[model samples]
Target chain A: MNLNVYLHAFTGVVKREFWRFIQQRSRFLSALVRPLLWLVVFAAGFRAALGVAIIPPYATYITYETYIAPGLCCMILLFNGMQSSLSMVYDREMGSMKVLLMSPVPRSWLLISKLLAIALISLVQVYAFLAIAWLAGVEPPALGLITALPALVLVALLLGSIGLFLSARIRQLENFAGVMNFVIFPMFFLSSALYPLWKMRESSEWLYWICQYNPFTHAVELVRFALYQQLNLQALAITLGTTLVFATLAVISFNPERTVRAAPAKA
Target chain B: MTIALQIDRVSHQYGQRVALDNVSIGLVEGQFNALLGPNGAGKSTLFALLTRLYRVQQGEIRLGDDSINRNPRALLARLGVVFQQSTLDLDLTVMQNLEYHGALHGLSTREIRRRAAEELEWLGLADRTKDKVRSLNGGHRRRVEIARALLHRPDILLLDEASAGLDVASRQAINKAVRQLCQERGLTVLWATHLLEEISLDDPVVILHRGRVLAEGIGRDVCERSDETSLDALFDRLTSAKEAHA
Candidate 1:
């Protein structure tokens, strides 16, 4: 409730996350490598079979790499989101969560600060990936980077909130790595991250409808449109709405009043 | 003298099992009150409620004039804690850990650095500020934790089994330091431990067993009342009755 305290803690939380991100060189490398692999190696193979339509975000046919770039960018956010939650589980196990949990700052503020930190870190990886994509001959509109920053941030918040909600709700949280794999693979493979919904519709109406409904698909579409200097209003509404929903769920689940266990470690 | 902390008939349960059964305690300012109990005597549970990590399901807990459920942030603002578990981020340097904790309490950056340096110097740990917490020994880690606890200038210090895993010398040193803190700072302390050796004969002691308080008085008084010679003997007599009864 204290603004000074809230702002100070917010800065500290973000700095700590940045320190953790930079300190673990391997984690940074892996976050970039996954998206790059899809952009460079996997995109080459899929380029022939997957033909992206001249969708609203696209005025004409685009190369598979160019088309999947936004999706892959969002892929970085998704992985980073899951990674943030995994570290939270690690914090719980290590007892490092005590300082944050016992703080006088409201639990909601603490969580929002953490989510913002995670989102900011995710931006780091997304930009790194975008730079690599540009070097590989997949150039988005130069102004698109500036315009996409806020959209990317919104998507980052959305994904991180989902991750936070999962971190709090999942009971078998010790197996969070397994949980991550299960969630990341399905959410990515099922959504429009890898292929277009229009293309998926040609294969099955059910999958097309599923992709349309997936919040992640909207997140990708938001980034995809923003990268081309276009605003996808439907994507904006879906992403913003989903962000609020998960953020609410995340805060509620992590609320201390709702937690009766002596320590979350035991729970 | 103001009551620094009070638990009014607080009770907690884990499913159908009672964790704390109508436990209560009244502690005045600057008092180093020891919560003496065997394992599973609800020592940790009591600390949880005090720290608001676990909400009070029944009765009320007050810090100064603010009841826990009434204005938790106000109560939390004046509270410091050393949990049974180590809460220091091991990957972070000692100063980083302290600074982060300071920030949590709404300390300005300048204030955080100044107070952190002061507290570390007081704890004799100014030289090791940049060392990663994982690099420090258990005793030094504990010292850093204690220093972090005081960074917020809290009126109450709740150490839940703070000396649980230390060697005898380390335990004695830390215990001595905490005792000194209570005197010098006028900070009320609720020290929870199962170790009878940790409590001085003159210190206020709350002996709890099986989620219930068995004795509530000065250690010497409890020993005298039970016709026991020392705290260790008094503890044995009180807790061993189940074996005799069985």
Candidate 2:
């Protein structure tokens, strides 16, 4: 009810999340490693086979690594999003989530604060990966990194909300592996993360449409455009719209009443 | 005595199975009340409703004058809870965990530190304040949770199976610590457990079985009213009678 109450609660949740992130050294290493592998090794292997035509964001032709750098940056956000949700599931099972939900603030506000925290952490990983990419000669314009900040954040929230929605539906921690396989892989592979939609169309029309329709594709495009100092209005609109829808669904599903009903009564 | 917390005609059903059936009880202010029920007797269900983890479907729960349905946030602000399961973050230090709880309740850092120091000192955990909960024993972890719950300084405390997994000595220690809070601070306390040894003869008790109230009153009075020789006999007789009927 009080503004200070909400602010303090938000700060508490954020601080706790950061503490957890810091303690888990392997998590930080893995978050950086996954995308870096794609940027460094996978892109190098595909450089000859994949030719990226001068995309709107790229004034001249670019190497495979340069073209996939934004996509891989979004990849880090995507994985971190799911990783945060996995932690949520873990917290729920371990009973630590009760500490968060029991706060006097509105459940919606608490969930949004959690989403924002996940987004902020994901941004750090994104920049870290970008810095590594820059050293590897895949530099975007200096101002473009600044410009891409908001886009990366928007995509992070979108991905995190999607993860939240999935976590709310997932009853047990064991079922999460299936989600990573079904949701994360398909979203990452079916999007333009590794190959342009045009290339996918040349192979198969159906795959092209699926890639185009995936909200993750727009998220990738949004980051891709921002990193090149351009704006993609359509991608921006779709990403923002999808973020709201998923976040709303997540908040509703995560309501204590609904979650309680969904959970099997322990005693 | 004023009833600080009231559960009125509350009922809950899981699909076709009723978890709690038209249950109602009043917790006397500044008293240590025990809710004794065997597993699957709706003890956890009642705690869930009290904590707002589950919605009150068929009845109302009031904290003082505020109905949980009408103003849950206000009630939550004044209520402290330690669940049947451990809710403390094992990775965080004792002080950090308490500080987090205080911040959740909107306390400033200076106030949180002061209260954390006091609660830790009272719980005899001041020396372990900087240690991660993972490094503590089960009894000490339970104590840390108790300290965290009290840091917010709520009017009533609900501890559901707070001593479930502790040794007998640790169980008694926690029971004593909570009872001390009731006497010293006049804080309303609800201690839920199936272990009869954890309860005293004079304490107010509520016995629940298969989602219904089997008996409620002073522990000895409830036993006498049922014509039983002891609390253990009373519980066994009451719960077994229902089991036989079912």
Candidate 3:
């Protein structure tokens, strides 16, 4: 398709999604509030309870709030991913997804276009949350703000693809809640969102290994490292590779035939 | 006349139950064929398969000599579909909906706007072009959908209960428009409806029951076998017989 065509489709989706969030002001507020609670209330309770450990590239003693900023950022990406997927299910039921699915262009391209749209929006919200965090006095290197953009984009894309992949399988919107509990929670809690890998190792080495291997952990680290203006080759490689894999699987699972069987009304 | 659409022994099933049993039908160029069936009688399934939403398990589908399963994109480009549910974005104006659809088919903005204007005029909806879809009456909304389907000038137009939820006046308007398109533009039309009153006596009607074709022919002739003068009674007999057998 021509660039203008792609731009029209992309802009339509982005505008629709953005307007949806705006219309539901409470949801936008909740998106900001949820992470703020974790940073303020939850982090305050555990700051002194948890011992400080000197890790590589940690220049000085950073408070719990500063340490979990990247994790909270990852949380935003994760939630946005699932939220987009939930909307996909909702649209399918309402027969709106059929409009996108039935377009004459390749289904994969259409799906990717949607993922990119979600990523762009999610990125915007993530930065908004970060700015709010900055106002809350969670200090980061000034240069870190500029460096985290690409890392956030990569994480958002990876998570968005995973959401799209899950969306293709969900028949009803209610089913997404279970995915949130099982996937989103574990991906967040088991990773270095609140604590360090070393801290987890002191408590349980196996848990530390799991955290190290968690793709979300890599996503967080990719941002965490870049926020410090440090190169994180491992994190970047893992995030990029995982993104490709999830994207491929999402496209496969979202095969048009399966989508038809899953929701005949949508097709 | 060249065959504009062809279905060859297509069969589809959902888990344990068959949705469309081995069945086939063809629509020639410039033909308006009515697909008649009761709820759960496989009419929707057939429509889904035709739109490539569901793949055929045992048969092939061809659109103008090209296997739909092989060249879905090319086939889809030449096909227009108005689904049973509302596909129009409620928040978007009618003109905006048409613009997005045209873009998906690779139309430039100027061309899309030009065609959108022409289509609205043709559908007698030029005044409502800028109105949000939710603000329109049911009939006007249906007209917009039909106009959107024609945005790409598809060779074949598929309507899956397009008149559902519309009032009597709107239904008549849609029927008139569809008939006119078939007669004047030579567009192949597959109009799916449960109401037999929607089918014309001279129109080709395919009666589907429980995923199989129960009867196919001129509407009057098919109804005549049961001494039914109208299409409705003919459909009642066909479906009642199947229900009894089941």
TM-score of each: 0.96, 0.97, 0.90
Q: Who wins the lDDT comparison?
A: 2
Error of 3 at B110 (Å): 3.8
Tens digits of per-residue lDDT for model 2 on A41-152? 9988889999889878889989899999999999999998998889888888888888877778888988898999999999988999999989999989999999999999
Best candidate, DockQ: 2
Per-residue lDDT tens digits for candidate 3, residues A1-267, read 567766666665665677666666777777788899999899899889875666644788888888888999989999999888898887777777767777777778777877887888788788888999999888678898889889998899999999988988887888987998888999999998778888899899899998988999899989998889987999999999999999999888885554443334321
Ranking by TM-score: 2, 1, 3
Pairs clashing in candidate 2?
none
Q: Give DockQ: model 2.
A: 0.67
lDDT digits (tens) for residues B118-215 of candidate 2: 99999999899899999999999988988888888899999988999889899999999999999999999999999999898888899999999989
Chain B fold agreement for model 3, TM-score: 0.96
Using TM-score as the measure, name the better of candidate 1 and candidate 2: 2
Please list the C-alpha lDDT of all candidates, in the order they appear: 0.86, 0.89, 0.83
Task: Output the better candidate (2/3) by TM-score.
Answer: 2
- After TM-score superposition, what is the CA distance of residue A135 in candidate 3 from its true location, in Å? 2.2
Question: What is the alpha-carbon lDDT for the whole of candidate 3?
Answer: 0.83
Candidate 1: segments with Cα more than 4 A from true spot: A255-267, B242-246
Would you give the TM-score of chain B in model 2? Answer: 0.98
Error of 1 at B96 (Å): 0.9
